[model samples]
Target chain A: MTELEIIRLYRSGQQEKAFNLIVENYSERLYWHVRRFVCSHEDTDDLLQEIFVKVWKHLPSFRGDSRLYTWLYRIATNETLNFLHKEKIRASLKFERLSVEMEEKIDDDPYFNGDELQKELLKAIQRLPEKQRIVFTMRYFEDLSYEDLSEILDTSVGALKASYHFAAKKIRTELKKSSIQL
Target chain B: MGKDILDDLKRNPYSVPDGYFDRLKGRLNEIAVSSVDTVPRSLWQRIRPYAALAACFAASFLIGNAILRKTAPGASSSDQFYKELMYSDLIPVTQPYAIFEMEDEEEMETSDEDIINFLIETGVSVELIAYVELLED
Candidate 1:
């Protein structure tokens, strides 16, 4: 169903149908958005469920102030950051350092099927500061407009552009140093 | 070099575990049910610290009772029962959980890199952040 149809269904008291449409419409996009930030398939799976749950809970109050997908992305992004925040805390508390944890997870991840360059590229992206990493993924990979990103991030357009520019520069340094070509 | 990096990075090198997207809706629906039970979750969160304190008190009480019983004159059958209760309650489950939490609390540290990098500009003022938070609640 279209976004409009989902909205209509929701406003008309068919909440389940409306929510299912939301899941159908944005689940994959939100999953990828989450996956890039978290960098672990298992973590992404768990976070995706949490994201959708938040979406379901908040859909009733969704006033169409912005696009539906944008709102969903905001929720997805916030939840991903929150999840990563807790994970960083958890890792430190247990003496399982994050850098070490990421190394082990990358090695053990069943879904990391990329070749060496691709793997290196992901590692480079991983090394980007968390917010820059997010900006890089959404801008460079997802091709979202700065206007849209600013809406979701609640940041100025110029700041986002600067972020992506610096992110690309950092990523380029990593790729060039590793001799990983496009 | 810049263009080359963008081109490579945009190649979409990631993949989810098999059947991940296919099963996503089902999984989401299941979680949504639990999240909707907001009352229970908030109640539990509010009471969690109290619950932990209560558990500690119970543990200490049992230990103290056992120590007194050990020192007192003719040990009754009830002494054996109380000793058994303390051993059963403290050793296998409660003690380990408390120890784990204690260790976790002690080691709660944050990485410097994480603090340095969380620099996304949220253009809202502190008051707006507080206001939005209020509206959210």
Candidate 2:
């Protein structure tokens, strides 16, 4: 269904149809986006569900100001930032808290095969500043245009291009150092 | 120069764990059922600001009415004064006898020409004329 139809269904209280449309339209795309930011499958799973829940709650406020995908990406970006911020705060309060959760989630995640190269790439991504990482993931992995990235990140096209460039450079260097191809 | 890196990143699409979306759909359904009570929580959220605004408007109306009621009597009296001034020309001389008596005495004492000449020669102010009339009364 078109975004308008989906919105109409949602506003008409047919939330099931609306959510089904969301799943059909964006599940895989959003999964990849979430996966890029988070390391393990369990974390991505948790974050993905939370992102959709947030989307469901806030969809009424969307107002069609931007494209549906851009709006969704903006939500994803915010959730990821919040997740990172909370993790940082928790770590500061007790350093072991983040590590323990990370270890448990990583160990328990069935989808995580823990390939050395993927691990290295994730570690490199974790080191990036949030904006660069988001830009890079959107541009490289999600294949979003500069315009869409700008809307999602609320950054200028030039700045987003620069961020992506720097992110790629960092990732390439990290991959090389770890002797991981591509 | 670094197009190759970007290309590689693009080519190697990230794989999600199998059945992630299906599981997510189930989890969402679970949340939806469990969150029926939480749904009303948002109803309160939506109503909160409007309720506050309604209270403010009601308070303002009451305060305005109170202030108006407090000052209404004074305002009405001032309005009466202005109304009297507007219709002053229509005010009837209630005691015509007194006015006729005053006019006759003044006419006997002085001719109109004498009064005019006195006014011209002395350059008597209107206030003096009013005072003389008052003294005669």
Candidate 3:
């Protein structure tokens, strides 16, 4: 279904139908986007449900100023970041490092089916600061352009470029420290 | 650079359980329909946690003051008592009010009320909040 049709259905008060269509179209993509941030399928699943609930509740106020998927990305990014932030606090309360815990989660993640190098890459990526890690995942895994990232992150394109560069360099440094070849 | 193995490991290494998306729509719809008529929380509801914390602090401080008045040997004047309390070994310098300083990097934009509301809304138990408060004490 086209974006216009969805918006029209929403406006016409056929919101549930429009929303189901949206869930069908965007749930998997959004799932992948969120899963890359969280690195746990269970967390991703719970967070995805919350994200879609937010989207449903707030859909009435959506003014169509941006493309629907960009708006959806924006919501997904914010919710995932918020979840991570809370997770960080929870970890701190237990005197645990959030990055270490997340890397451990990646290591034990049953859904993860990568080779040794890919697993190490994910661990290195998890060690990055939150925003930089999200930027790296969205750029490298999801293949989103800087413009899309800028819109979703509400960051300047220049800043996003610099963040991605520093993130890549940091990941390489971490990989080298682990003696992972090239 | 050995052709940058980062570029070589390009395929996404994640998978979901079978038919996860197939069930997601129905699950979300159930939540949405049930929650559609739920009113937004009032401001008072949002700030109740912080207000409770403040009330607890005030009550505890007053009780401590009263106990000090009855028990301290030479804490005659309220001013003198406060002066000693400020300088006394009773309250450690490191632990005082530091837990309340929760303005971390991620929470700079969030208001205190919002944080309290978020904690409560996320099912942080009253005992945990009190435990955090006890940590503050």
Per-candidate interface DockQ score: 0.34, 0.12, 0.37
Stretches > 4 Å off in candidate 3:
A176-182, B36-137
List where candidate 1 sits over 4 angstroms from the true fold.
Answer: A94-97, A180-182, B1-3, B31-137
lDDT of 2 by residue, B96-117 (tens): 4543453436456767568857
For every candidate, C-alpha RMSD to the true structure in Å: 29.5, 15.0, 25.2
Candidate 2 yields a Cα-based lDDT of 0.71
Q: Report the number of the highest-lDDT candidate.
A: 3
Name the best candidate (by DockQ).
3
Query: What DockQ was computed for model 2?
Result: 0.12
Say which prediction, candidate 1 or candidate 3, comes out ahead on TM-score. 3
Give per-residue lDDT, candidate 2, residue B102.
33
**What's model 1's TM-score?**
0.65
**Residue A130, candidate 1: C-alpha displacement in angstroms:** 2.3
Candidate 2's C-alpha runs over 4 A off are A11-13, A95-110, A113-115, A180-182, B1-6, B9-18, B30-137
Candidates sorted on DockQ, descending: 3, 1, 2
Per-residue lDDT tens digits for candidate 1, residues A1-182, read 77778898889987776787788778988888887777788888888877777788788889999888789999999998898789889998997766567756776777776767767777777777877888888998788999999999999999999999898889778878787344
| Winner by TM-score | 3
Candidate 3 C-alpha error for residue B105, in Å:
65
Per-residue CA lDDT of model 3 for A54-162, tens digit only, reads: 8987998899988898999999999999999999999999999999999899989998888887888898888888779988999999999999999899999999999
* Model 3 alpha-carbon miss at residue B9, Å: 1.8
